[model samples]
Target: MKKTTSFVSIGTIILLLFIHGCSGCKKEAQNLSDSPKKTFIGPFMNEDSILLYVQKQLECGPRNPGSNGHSSCKEFLINFLKTKADTAFLQTFSSMVYGRTYEMSNIVASFSPDKKDRILLCAHWDSRPFADEDETPSKRTLPILGANDGASGVAVLLEMARTLSISKPNIGIDIILFDGEDLGLSGDLNGFFQGSRFASKNYPLPKPKYGILLDLVGDKQAEFRYEPLSQQAHFVLVDNIWSIAKERGSPYFIHETGNSVSDDHVMLNEQGIRTINIIDVNLVGNISTNPRRTYWHTSRDILDNLSMQTMSDVGNVLLDFLFTTSDSVY
Candidate 1:
């Protein structure tokens, strides 16, 4: 994911105000319900299992396109998804970067394919080819391991898949691990989100009602805020997820709005898919006060810098949201 800008547009502020007003009305409507709230039971997410998935991805080395690690990791992810998902496959495409053509594949796994009501969960799986943000000038040309930027989100989704395999949700779920998300050079927006661009153009059958994207979610000091683009695309879905986090007393999901990001979700939204990004924007660009921001696109983004507890927090919120909410809620 790339930080497009630190400032929010005027239109976004107006939209946010409108949403806030509507939320008040919705709350009033909910208060009139005499029926008691239903308890949502979801499968437990094991932190140890999630960490192991991250470790296994790192074991394959940097997953940059045209590298051996890329090929091996692709095989590993596809095989693992096949074991758990009712239907799992790869969407292959080609892209030209820096005057060279490269082959890329987006790994997709579907649960309860027959169900028409569906939601999409996605994250980028490819590591950056160059550590452009590394403090050391010499290391800028080297590839990063992307323990938090890439592997973290994928790890959470893999764990979700494992649990979903054990206990199915009422609604259909689609997990897509988008490739080539970190291929862009500094400030080159066109080079990013190649896999998402292709996938959005050729959407899967039985399209999802809404989508959530996870990125940089494993940092020990991760703080997720409302991304403006997400709120603009589907403010109700964003409010619903955040409200769930608030109910669960999650410290990671902040109620305040954060910086806008140019990521895979942006590509999907452009294609008319209402997608929101759950990412730690503070750990990405210049506005961050967190010390871990140093690890962005750097060699320092290793397994040691990640926190299983942080990933579990985000994962649990997703589980609760998926299991508790009905199709009408979103």
Candidate 2:
């Protein structure tokens, strides 16, 4: 969710591993914008329930690291996941970015942990502290609401969590809610993806078959593209997902080229997990703002800019992929 310069989080579990030097230790661990066309009638995804999750996150306020909102949001997610996941734990980490130290946690919820094969679904929960891309310079210091930027992805995942919990999937599932992801400045890849980097270097669970990252998939006119790195890293995997998107009748899953973002998926792929990201880089363009779509990392990234249909499109597509795709490919 950090402003894209075309590329790229850590949490506490890895920090303890470093301090204790334990190998057998256990640990825990975006955006709103999308546009989906066609009548996608799916029993698996509930738009109203998904939208409610987004509203709850917004009611907690901006979840920037070290803030009360962040703390409350973390508790809410863990509590909710506890009801849905087989096991849930917190992966905490600390680091210094831009000369300031911040403490953060990555929430990990495991489903069907006994199954060897798994799929990773990830999204960052923290909102940008500075509206660096705001049109108004005076409002640049204000925090972003992240309705489409942060909560959209989570809302879809939360709905999926509930769905999968009630009716289990064949393969194991791991949904990672990363922290400190939007804390970096544009083009500063190292400062961003703190939680993901830690997860990559210190995988708390079995390596997933592959991963799908959802970001900015809640916009009214959301569209997804084949990321350059994802295409380069896993050719057939890209085709497989886009094909599923197509088969699911998701107009937002455009099988075209997209900007090479340094997001959470990039870190996972770097860890040899072969993950792909499905994000809507063109959100603010279609989102109606006072001066057209307000840019990312802006003060205008509030809940009013989101759409429930967009959430359903992305969520239902992933549901189909998970139900249909096989582990033999990965």
Candidate 3:
């Protein structure tokens, strides 16, 4: 996805505020009550397993749309999720990008399918078709391996799914692996988020209450600041997740506000899902002090740049929030 100054209009912002205000009042009243919080014990996210999942995706090569790697990875993800989740399926559609009509599918896996209260966790599984950000102009046309950009988030969720299969959470969970997220050329917003736009329009039953999107999150130097769009769309969700990270003494989840990103979560928020993104803000945009910025959309985005410890931290935080947090908080 590309960076943008603003996506939501003033009128839309006001409507969102009104909607959130009504719900916020009810949650506030619930928070005031002296209800005991639930305690959850589950298997720890294995760092080795997380690394193995990332390696498995990279083994499929660059999963760009219409490529052999994309086809293989799609089957692998679907088959894997089907074994772990209560229900898993594909949402298929065709879209024309850069004058080419490509078949794409969003891999969706649901846990506790009958539960009314649920949350969403998602990541793009498709790698960029071209390394537009490569410093070597000659290499710009090649596809990126996307170990960090694509596979990392999916790897974390795969591990989460494995753990959830063993120990179910109180609330339902939907893990969606979005396709064609990086098919866009630089500055071409319409080419991006193809899967999210479609999924938002055709939501599944037992819709999620809120969502947390993971992107550019497995790099060794990754730092997650409060993304502006996420903060504006769902401040409470952001605060709660960040608070959990801090309580765990995490060095990655910084409390300061960061850059605005136009990503898949934007599409979900537009559909009134109130989703937030947990991304390495500096690495995605043009400016950054981190060296990993050079890897964005570049052929250098390989398995060497990923960090299993970083992925585990993100997964642990989500598990804590999902299992321990009271039902009323959601």
Each model's total of backbone clashes: 0, 29, 0
* TM-score between model 1 and native: 0.87
Per residue, candidate 1 scores C-alpha lDDT tens digits across 1-330 of 011111224434654665677886655544533222334466768999999999999999999998888999999999999999999999999999878888999999999999989999999999999999888999999999999989999999999999899988799999999999999988989899988998999985578998999999998878899999999999988987887777677788999999998899999999988899999997776357656567899889899888999998899889988876636555
Is candidate 1 or 2 superior in TM-score? 1
**What lDDT tens digits, residue by residue, belong to model 2 across residues 206-278?**
8898888888888776768888887877777788778667756667788789777778888988889888878
Ranking by TM-score: 1, 3, 2
TM-score per prediction, in order, is: 0.87, 0.84, 0.87
The alpha-carbon lDDT assigned to residue 54 of candidate 2 equals 99
Global local distance difference test of model 3 = 0.86
Q: Compute the lDDT of residue 262 as modeled in candidate 3.
A: 96
**How well does model 2 score by local distance difference test?**
0.79
Candidate with top TM-score is 1
Q: Which stretches of candidate 1 lie over 4 Å from their true place?
A: 1-39
Cα lDDT of model 3 by residue, 185-268, tens digit: 899899999888888888855678898999998988789999999988888888878877876767899999989999999999
Clashing residue pairs in candidate 1, if any?
none
Give the range of the ten consecutive residues with the poorest summed lDDT in model 1: 1-10
lDDT of each: 0.87, 0.79, 0.86
